[model samples]
Target chain A: MKKVALLTAAIIICAVPFYGQHFITKNGHISFYSDGPLEKIEAHNKQVNSALNIETGDMVFKVLMKSFVFEKALMQEHFNENYVESDKFPNATFKGKVVNMSDITLTKDGTYEADVEGELTIHGISNKIEDKGTFIVSKEGIHGNSKFNILLADYDISIPGAVTGKIAEEIEITVDVKLKKFSK
Target chain B: MKNWIKVFVLAAVVGIGVLIYVWFFIYNKPHMNIEKATPDYIISASECYDHYANGNNNETLNYTGKVLQIYGSPSSIEKTDSLTVVVFTFSTGMFGDEGIRCTMLPSYSNEVSNSILSKEISIKGYCSGYNETDVILEQCSIIKN
Candidate 1:
């Protein structure tokens, strides 16, 4: 009977960390920049929702298209009304996994390179993407940063002839999020 | 010959004036004035979350891009590196504490700091749609009574 009790206590102790394996942040930051001959465009969306399960290597990100704020009001208006059509497709999401989850240890304080693979959906189009990012594990939380480039044509975001030289065909996106341990 | 020259000069001046107006007013219009604009829907924070939490995507989509005036006690007011965020927590579900997360406008940073917890207050912002777990609002400003 004592042996069984000892085994039960051991299992309970090991299960504690598993319960806190999920990390989430509602205010993740995501920004994109476009460099063209005539102009450079940049926008930032601070209210990004992201979730990561360290144990399972599964991660997800969602951002409202209309949430992206531009430096100029006209650029923002044209982006929503003409380009991405935020009224029709309001949300852009990424459902992916950390391919190299085994290489990183969350309990230890260190920065590890991660290979993330998954599907990114924007403007109602989905594309498989594999990118590299770094995860900094600390006592506070995990800070994840990744920079990648995507072609606007791949996402069906077309530029009008009048502003062909004003917007780039390719845009760079940066993701920065500090995920905290999810607790009930 | 003199009349033709005068007409050409007058046309060129008018064209320049029109170009300037288009550049300043039309092509470079000002952003939406959130402070002066009225809210499209005035509802409680909990009620707003309910529309999304219940998986009513169509109903929830109606609020997107629209300014909302939500009233409730804030769960927490946190200052991030860039801006201040006012959160109205609904529940701690499988993902996390899901609710309405409002990114306050920088101009109202002081007003957000003075916000009392558990005391009913109103906030107005542009509804940016639900991100599965939480309803995101941007350019938020406190609504004075």
Candidate 2:
């Protein structure tokens, strides 16, 4: 009887955190854009770094260095081998918190705009960033959409003179994330 | 008469040289565009394993998936043939309660140290589905960081 009680208590302890509202999806969409005179270059990595800790309202995201695919094979290779050196720095990640987790109940149908602040790491560099997005809480999962700007130089990405006009200094990024509440 | 023949020969030689240069340098150059050529079906490491476990064979244009971020050295599969494969393991879900471990077989060209094996990578390839313990992706190209 004592063992049964201990097991029950352990299960409850493990299940308590899951009772909160938090959902995750491995297949999330994260896209970025950089335009230049020669070409309008756009690349995206679906395998982004992502996690949502419901108990703490902390969300994290990651993307592999070598996963950002542009339109050209040579360009992709250069971006990995020469520019990003994916072998050296394998991933880009973001860790932040949802400002208003208690105010919104994600299980029911509702829309809430939350401010998220976190450290965005890319090209082996980490920077503190803040972004705002709309989060729609549904019975199925959580949907989030946000956009932000990043400077190529901020991450030490140097565009050669030959392709200088082809790439922009500042690029716009759009993220459409959908996370499912973790089943306890 | 001799001078005119020599002049004609010289002109012909230059023309042939120019033609050769155009053929080799202009036309025979690499036409593959890396940015455009990368397979877009970017899938997460765990999802890649799931597809392999289920034995799903579908070649899509691109995949949008997540990168597995676990701290550990990567392990390479002993090569049965000329092609050697590597494996990485991840939990069933990104952030789940129960940690159901799954393995991912990434077909890579270059080799890294065991210590640096967990180098996160996003690979785009033609999914040929599962092969025994490994998932097969053909003609994969590495995306930029």
Candidate 3:
């Protein structure tokens, strides 16, 4: 008990000077499209987890598999149970850096095209990705837009023969991000 | 000697089982409460908006209801040095309207009063009165949503 109290006191003292980095709006939007011979369906979830460090080029993004709601209720369930299995794999994340970190002034308003290189972990698989996007930075906040393609097989996700043609082998993912400055 | 070994092994297994049970179930329960049980003024989202529109200076208001929905994505969830403290943010609003938005901070489970984010969520807490920039929800409860 005495040791625990001492540790607690030490933690409080150490944390006094340190504060939190708040992301005003730390989410984004991602969409999935599966084009079939007869039909093309597109669905999206705007609630995305995203964060950026103004001091460093460090950044991260996440989304809960279960949070992906579709226009059709049955599709959402299939997504969780059959495809995503959200309960087993709760989140997808990406950790990377903005290439030109020093040149960017986030407090000012401007448009920038930069390369973001990171290790993206999805479905318990991690891959190196070098994607580019347009970033808008202003005294107000940060907004980013980008799109890239991902192969289902690259992640070892199988498309059964029954639905093989229904879902595209290569799906284009669009990234729409909006973030706010963390107040000191 | 053989019987003694068997008894020791059984005791070890039972101890491990008890530890696992306590960690996953008993200790994982949420119980953080910010305010004590005292009748306080409770408000609703629409009502809270009305107060802001009316230019009410009262920074505190209580809202009680089940969480109809949780509409934001989280960047990170971390505990602060403070006891049972947390701070995080959701992506700002989408489709044109945007800003700091509303977020759930580190709240005491007891202060929450039976509200779960994934289930029926009712929050009786304080609002810093809506601003064009941010909406703050504090000391809330899950009434039944």
Which 10 consecutive positions of candidate 2 chain B have the poorest summed lDDT? B59-68
Per residue, candidate 3 scores C-alpha lDDT tens digits across A1-184 of 9999999988975563222343434346778776767445566754566767655566777665544546554455566667656545656777787888677766578998867999887778889999898889876678888898888777766766787777777778888877776653
The DockQ ranking, best first, is 1, 2, 3
Which is the leading candidate under TM-score?
A: 1
lDDT of 1 by residue, B5-26 (tens): 9999999999999999999898
**Better structure of 1 and 3 per TM-score:** 1
lDDT winner between candidates 1 and 2: 1
Query: lDDT tens string, model 3, B1-145?
Result: 7999999999999999999987664544333333343424544444444443444544322221112122222222222232121122322331123322233334443342222223323344433233332233444333443
Candidate 1 residue runs with Cα over 4 Å from true position: A1-20, B55-58
TM-score of 3: 0.52
Candidate 1 or 2, higher TM-score? Answer: 1
Candidate number of the best DockQ: 1
Residue-by-residue lDDT tens digits, candidate 2, A148-177:
999878887788777776767888999987
Q: What docking class should model 1 receive?
A: medium
Task: Tell me which of candidates 2 and 3 scores higher on DockQ.
Answer: 2
Quote the positional error of residue A171 for candidate 3 in Å. 1.1
- Interface DockQ of each model: 0.58, 0.10, 0.02
Give me the candidate number with maximum lDDT.
Answer: 1
DockQ of 3: 0.02
